[model samples]
Target: MKRFTCQSCGQLLHFEDARCDQCKAPLGYMPEHAILSALAPQGGGLWRPVRGCGNTALRTFCSNHAYDVCNWLVPPTEEHSDFCFACQFNRVIPNLNIPGNMERWRKLEIAKHRLFYTILRLKLPIKNRRQDPQEGLVFDFLDDSPDGAAPIMTGHSNGVITIATKEADDAYRERMRVEMGEYYRTLLGHFRHEIGHYYWNVLIRDGGRLEKFRAIFGDDRMDYQAALQRHYARLPQNNWREYYVSLYAMSHPWEDFAETWAHYFHIVSTLETALSYDMTIGPIVDGQATLTHKSDPYLLMPFDDIIAAWLPLTYAVNSLNRSMGLADFYPFVITDGVRTKLRFIHDTVREVQQAAS
Candidate 1:
């Protein structure tokens, strides 16, 4: 979400831009540093990267050059690799040889990169299966076979994430949203929410925070299959709003954690954006705002401080959203009971950071 510049012409560039209109420079993303750099064309359509990146020594091409779905640079060091960091996470992408699959894959990567940007910004640990097969993350970008050979699924388990290829299609996603009765659905939201599932394995189960986590999210040891089946079997009761963020959270303790984890990123990222703009008035300077640097996350702003700020901030945002024609930016209100659950999530994150340190 930070602004990018074209190294070739020094013109401001968009993250999604394949070519800079001002200088006609080819652009590529430096995935390691989350940068978008522009390139000057050499003869024979070989674009020379003008950015002072280590990857340049490796001589790489952006995914845009291949499928137009990737903006991330693939270093020559990874010459044999077919995907960038965002695309690399995918285990079963649609058939790229298909006319539309490349475009579909492209959309999914954009959202995946956005998800990664937040994870990186927060200084969260990320290791893919290719890097660490034992516990590293992976993804499956699949679909109900075009030939009707198999059904597709999108969910997270253990350390892997799966996304249906149809989720990449705007029309298909909208149809699913209506059919599933969801108020909001986006590729970004799915990545964010599913990664929330991954982080539970990464952060909570390993951090010895399970007891406290169980106290709030219910017991995560419960059977996931039965819980999920029961949830879909009956409509989630709306009256339980005071206890959970979304109806899906009512499905199981693991779900509640995942939903809350996603919300934590939502709150932290937006607050940092607001702070970057210096958009606050009458600064009651929360201590976390002081410690959690806008550019570098040293530590999560104190868990208590964030909740205190959120209580009022979400209220103001909801009211403002109503004043405008749009629906509420944050549809779910965290009640007092839910606040206790969120506190556990916040504390567990700190524990993870401490353990990593």
Candidate 2:
């Protein structure tokens, strides 16, 4: 995520900002230009970018802007569509008429938009239902049934990713984190993890990389439901960390791929944020050298360079958290096997990107 600033007044801006705080200039994110621009009203609900902001053409906020959920802009050419690039993928949004549902949907949108940020930055292929009805990316923000039956389980099926609205509640989410014994659980993590499954179908299964995937991730042909059942029924394996990113990843090759894939996104995206801020790490210990990020992790950086920067950055951040009596910022460890899997993911992404280009 690149740091953004108000083009008009130079006020620092966050990705979700709808208006610049210092100058009070309206802000909108231009996905094609990848900049948050200050807007000048043009007439009849249209806006133009302020001077120096990329794209001089008139634009309009996504229809979702009416709900204050999206800040992305829509070009005039896309007038036929009401949603922005990110919001267009929604197959179902939370029932806004229901109490607290709007807030939940807002939280979900923030995380989902961030997920799309990384996806677009990586130049990964994406198609909405309109493009490919069978396996195009889409989302369903659902609530558990009112009848007290089974709750809405957050997972991916085909191309549809269903997220439970309850996860947006901090209390409920934290409780589930403790109950599941997960070190990290957040709305963003859910999006990243589930999208990994969607990509596995697109890039590995349909793209003819299954053999290579099986080599690194193990045979995914093993029955998924049986693997999940056995995973929950058995005790945690002492050597699980040696081969998997998480205990749940040890359940099946498919899961291992998704977990590792999500971790890849986490690493690259966070590293990009660090780089945008020009962050560097230096320890005073003997024989230790200073670290600085110079390449774009999403495109130009070597996989080895990414890991080299990632480990030290995690160590520094984790120590900072410990100083404040907070849990480690990053709780997982990457072993040799996990590193190999991560490299495989990196290579696959670059391969797909190059082929697409």
Candidate 3:
């Protein structure tokens, strides 16, 4: 995610900030311009960007803002719609009247909004069910059955991504992480991984890249159910690290793609944050090389350049985490095989971006 600042007072801002601490100015994120702008009230719930903040036209907060779950702006052009570009994708939200569901929904929104940030930043194609009824991306945040029936499983089907609301609880998520033996897991990671499935349908299956995809990620046509059953039934290969980004990625070709795709997002987004902060890693030894953020990872950096910057950054941050008595900031390794899959995803994203331009 790119760093943001309050345009009115120049106070450093986070992507989710609703107000500027220095100037006490109300803030709203303008997704079209990808800026979090300080706002000036214009009566009747409308607001305009403070002078010199950008877009002079009046705007209003998304309907979800009423729930304090979204901080995105709704432009006059989209006044007919009640939700922002990101919120419009919601097919079902959690039951707010139920105790604790409100907080869980808020956490879900934060992660979902961040997911949309990367999606928009990369200029990926996305639509709501209204635009493409057959396969438009949508979300369903659901609760497990209260009567002791089967639990909700978070996954994607066609264009819908369902997230088990319980995952929003940190304790629950952490427990599951231990039981599943995952190196890393979070709500944002879940969004990134599942959206990969949605994009596979759009950018690979429909975009005519299946042949190339198969050669790199293997044949996705294999029996997915059987592959998953086998994966759970047997022990992971001792050498799985050589070929997969995570143990779960060894389950199926589709999973490998999704896992790698999620890691690709992790790499580029974190690199962009480092670049925004002008972060650099100087050589510890006299003649060793230095790492600097020289290019925009989302727009200009090649796959090789991204990997070069990411590996060193990971090393630096992971060490910082260890020094502070925390787990590695990035727990997975990027092997040559994993890099090949990541490169495929990077190239495919660039292709879609160029075509759109």
Q: Estimate each model's TM-score.
A: 0.79, 0.97, 0.97
Per-residue lDDT of model 1, residues 147-266, tens digit only: 787667788877778888888899989898889877668898888889988888877787566787787878888898999999899976667878888778899998898887777777
Model 1's alpha-carbon lDDT is 0.73
**lDDT per residue, candidate 3, 95-187, as tens digits?**
888899999999999999999999999999998899999999999999988895999999999999999999999999999999999999999
- Candidate lDDT values, in order: 0.73, 0.91, 0.91
lDDT of 2 by residue, 54-119 (tens): 568989899999999999998667866788899999989999988999999899999999999999
Scanning candidate 1 in windows of ten residues, the lowest lDDT window is: 289-298
Off by over 4 Å in 2: 282-289
Error (Å) of candidate 3 at residue 245 is: 0.4
Q: Ranking under TM-score, best-scoring first?
A: 3, 2, 1
Q: Positional deviation of 276 in candidate 2, in angstroms?
A: 0.8
TM-score of 3: 0.97
Task: Please state the error at residue 267 of candidate 1 in Å.
Answer: 2.5
